[model samples]
Target: MLLLFVHSKAQTVTGRIVDSEKQSVVMATIALQTLDSINICATTADADGRFVLTADSIPLPFRLIVSSIGYETVMPECASYAVGDVVLATKTNVLGDVVVKSKRPILNVQGDRIVADASSIIKGRIVTCAFDVAKYVPGILCKNDNELSLAGTMSTTVLVNGKVWNGGSVLEYLKTLPAEKVSKVELLYNASPDMHVTGAVINVVLKDNKGRELTGQVKSSYYNNHHNTFQESGSLFYTTPKWSLYSMYTFADAKSISRSQYLSHHTVGNQVYDIDVDARTHSSSLTHAVYTNATYNVSDKSNVSLSYNASFSPKSDTKGRTTNSYFSNSNYTTSGNSYMHNLHLAYVLKQLRLDANYMSYSNDGTQDMNYEKYENPTAYSYWRKQTSDRFNFSADWGFPLWKTARFSLGATYAYSKTGNRQK
Candidate 1:
């Protein structure tokens, strides 16, 4: 009698993970285990949610478990060489996992985004607004008074309550927004296509407050060097179930002194010539701006919003002096003013915006020069006037394709005309 011994060959299993909407779920953890609770193999899904795992020779009926952030877990039982798709539902709400008196982690990693618990992290800290709390966030830098960057990238957009913040300058608005109103802050490094923005963004989720309420803030700053700079601002908001209104005003008075030096060396026809010059400028300006916005909720799915913004620089004056080593010393002065206005309207996810801008500039000044090399003095005076009118119109609309995705299209038109005279 002849007896033959055969061994079973191990088989490979491949599958793809996706969300309920059939979108690929990347960075998901997939594990295979034996029926008796023995670990066999484990792997992670690639960008396309494809994974491959090998079954052992014993083939004891294994099961697969797939899990990802912000999604429900999936478990499928199979034998050998099970290849197909695994679907996961979104984790919108969990009743069994609720703990009312528990503290959330300061940092949580969601796919391509970091959710920070600003309320919990800023506890016991002197944070009056989000700007004050930004310094504590990881991988974020406040480069200047009005600039914020994520890691190394400088371009960043800010959103409040899941909607784009159309308020004035981000730095100015942040100063007036109360920190306590923030529930969480999401840092999105890899934004979705619907976001439109190409760089990192910060999304601030505000608390869900019902009923009517009023909130506002005031801010002022002063700086003194050779000249003095002053800034004052105020913001106010009133909210109700049907309508809400927000307004902000700012005033700035600034004076500055600048100095520059220039040097050049050139050769012409076997002759070398060198020139050195030093220049100094003194400037002062006054600016006033007002921004107001209002929204009326027509229904749960739609709303109407209107916004108006106006800015004016009453006076801007500049005085400059230049001293040249080989020629003359020149002095001059100039002054001008400018104004702008913008009006915006939106219906739900569609917006129509218009802007009317005007500027009137007049420079009545004199240039006096002393030619040191020639021992001669000369003077000249001139008057110049200029005015400009510009108008711009734009319309944008967004179509919701998925729960978290959208298709956006827009159009814009701008026109400007100017008139000038010189003497």
Candidate 2:
């Protein structure tokens, strides 16, 4: 019993020593080399074709080379195969598929549908919004309208932090959230569920803080076009750990500094042939945003999250125009801004998920056209507000989509209203 105890603790090599044809070769030399230089072990195969040998202090990269009469010598893992595991492929051309390894990705390996890491935009990595990120993956494209299309289909429904922004186009929402804040983008392909189907499906996965404890970054940039932008972000988290309370908080702020040239040639007149001319005009817009999310995990497989997003964009413009008719000329200037938000709570247990989402959106915009058309052109001003509430519940059921893939179905309902508070 004492000898057996020692044998179990030490690494053992037990297998058959065979010829090139896999026929048992008795009396063949089986050498086991230990890196300790002084330690080495050897044995001979039995008549029944099996051998068991024990050794102490054997080092890694142990190799077994067999040679016998009239057969080609073979090595499993070679540089040709790239199987570099020392334990499985120690010598020439030895390859073992059962061994686990890490290598350069030809495709996404695990964890969700895919993984995308942000690189510096100056390095040709342009991550402007959801469309920019979506363009990085295969089968996703950006349309002329700045909308996202996948698999030849337009309008991809998007879910951010587990709530539907449902703004027809997610380009606006994607711009509000920083690309660095996103951990993964799940391509919900051929979705049968009504709640997530727009024409295609996109789920923006945020960086989870549950196990991270703390993480975030800040960035600022300048452009050749006389524009500047800056951003700041941070996150704090505490997983249940050994106890049973989980909490996480994330926040980000961004201010966009942008400029543009608005040049137009115009013709306005009582005479059908007579025309008006134009000159140079310039416009600048600034946008600031704040977004936050708080999540609490109640138990091992249960949790709830609350999130808020608020943003505003104010634009200013200066203009001048000249009409060839009577050599008329005029100039005008104005500014406008808008805000939007989403509030939500959610729960998750196993294959079931439930959530309540409320959203408030407001926009006020104006443009001043100084010409012969209006008797008194006070900047064209418009303001609107909208509110929406939605309850969503879903459960997972396994159905075969193909021999290799499965189907997951879910549903949702929403109530909403829109109004013009100021006209």
Candidate 3:
């Protein structure tokens, strides 16, 4: 009798909703109530369309309803049971899974060369010049003012975004260009091909130009030193998909104060001269630069580009110098002026680049000498002029290695002849 009652109750309760075939239906409709009562409770099915109620203890004559979009409604009551495959006889709908991903840069790898992106996360505040960038890069060193050394060599060929930017010191150049514009600054150790034996090579990669429209920036700054001094500057940039343009101009006026104390002893061949002295110096300079560039898509694999850059450094100084020795003694003074001009041009290819640069720098200054000797000697007043002319040309080639690696080779020839005359 119990087995018969269980079988009868199982037939009364039913559940489940699906599409044609055995696929589950999502969000179907379900209803439940007392078997003989008109009152009912209805709710939407869950994602799986499998609904459950008090099937173990429902009053006799209780009823449950199941229905789905465009499907025949199912009615059963009084006991516990489960049913499925209430497959709809309608058309099927299909969906695809959505995916999310983002891009990032890679760091720390094994290779003979080291690439230091000037814009890496390692960069920090107080990075006002290339020296600050060098501090974070391995195998790069800047020992003193106006000095750029690489690896073990004293002379290095540095390129700014594949272009020869010889207008100023490397550190000054880095300052002129905001660090944000830098994408990577690479240090190539012992340039390959047994012949480049000069200093190591450095390439400063800048951000690429995109967008079909226009964009740029303008900025100015002030700099101060230990002495009461100050300087100011401004710059701008713009770009487009078919062409690009950039122009920057900077100006500085400054003064410096310093004190020095020293003692020395000299013995040369058969002569000896010992001297002690204290000295102070004050100097200033006015400098500025303007640059412009453009590119035209001559073909798909090749493009033509031209650029011009000019800067002026007019230096004037007032120096007071004194000399004291056993054989002769003198107090001297010097005041002077100097200026420089530089120009450049280039053409580029997909795998190669060619460029030429010329510079004419002149220094015409006077060295005034006054003398007071007690050793039976005489001195004369004097002045002098110095001049320098420089020219440079280079070509670079990049070759792909087995479609995975890349090799870049380049050659540069530079000549700077300088002369000084005194009268």
Q: lDDT for each of the candidates?
A: 0.66, 0.45, 0.55
- As a whole number from 0 to 100, the lDDT of residue 39 in candidate 3 is 30
- Where does model 1 exceed 4 Å of error? 1-105, 108-113, 158-168, 189-198, 203-209, 260-277, 349-423
Candidate 2 residue pairs in clash (backbone atoms < 3 Å) = 75-93, 76-93, 76-94, 76-95, 77-93, 77-94, 77-95, 276-324
TM-score, one value per model: 0.58, 0.50, 0.58
TM-score of 3: 0.58
Write candidate 1's Cα lDDT for 1-423 as tens digits.
999998877778888988889988776656566565444555567778888765544364667766664565666777656658899777665469873331222555544466677876577567888776554454455666566655433367776544444324656666667776678877765454444455567777765445698999898999875789999988888888887888889999999988899999878999988889999999999988787878787766667777776777778888888888877888777777766666666566333222222222332333333334456676666666666565544555666677634666766566777777777
lDDT of 2 at 203: 64
Model 2 Cα lDDT, one tens digit per residue, 50-83: 5554555455655443322122222231221122
What ordering of candidates by TM-score runs from best to worst? 3, 1, 2
Q: Give the distance in Å from residue 324's predicted Cα in candidate 2 to where it truly belongs.
A: 5.0
Candidate 1 whole-model C-alpha lDDT, 0 to 1: 0.66
